[model samples]
Target: MTTRGPLLAFLLSLVVGLCLTVPAGAVQPDEVLDDPALEGRARALSAGLRCLVCQNQSIDDSDAPLAKDLRVLVRERLKAGDSDEEIIDFVVSRYGEFVLLKPRLLPQTWALWFATPLVLLVALGVILFSYRRRKALAKSPKPLTANEKRRLKRLVNED
Candidate 1:
């Protein structure tokens, strides 16, 4: 009964902790578009942008002031009748391509993108060839005379 009480209390606390919602105040109401479709587009654009301050998070998810400013800028661009691509281009021009979560597939970007997989394939082929060669060497019977075997066995027994 005593153990059960502590366990129940812990479980209750865990449940309460899980239910608590952390408020994200990154995007203010004024930044949102009045049109629902435009607002959705703004959100989509924001999500695609990487937060410069919080490098790992999207601008949509980051609470950094810079991220908020970027979000507001996106909304403002959308309100100014800028197309999604135009808004993206505006931001990309301001910041580098690193600002985009998914970068454009340009020639330079393709080189960076394809380099890893090509390198991995070359490494894998080398490793597999080495493994097969080692196995073949291990399996191939070594030539040994009866005299040599006898001498080897005697040496082992002496040791």
Candidate 2:
């Protein structure tokens, strides 16, 4: 056999080995659904779930054990014939709204959604108030007392 034949075969084997060893995010092979449509829905739901252990990463993107469990839970919910919203609401009820990447706009979440704009308005008001006060002060002059007027006359005479 030629050296080229052996070298090509070794390179191909190495590529295939590397591909097989790399884990695809948190989804395991056994967790995937046989139905492509259901599998797609599971993936979508996983992407929306915040992994409690990982905090910032979605269950679909995190490798934490909790994230894997959440991924499996999402698949199970899908298999049970739950609609996407129902599955999401079920998870939210168990984990609180923190499990959602984008939390719903509810009374409890109003402060979170409105805090920045309210703070900005307050800051802008403070800035504008201070600026107007400084401008008014600059425009008005205080009258000097009689003693200060006499001192000014003496200084002018000396000059």
TM-scores of all predicted structures: 0.74, 0.69
- Writing each residue's lDDT as its tens digit, candidate 1 over 53-83 gives 9887789888899999999999888989999
Tell me, by lDDT, which candidate is best: 2
Compared with the true structure, all predictions reach lDDT values of 0.89, 0.90
Off by over 4 Å in 2: 1-24, 140-159
Worst 10 residues of 2 by lDDT: 20-29
Give every collision pair in model 2: none
Return the number of clashes found in candidate 2. Answer: 0
RMSD to the true structure for each prediction, in A, is 4.6, 9.8
TM-score of 1: 0.74
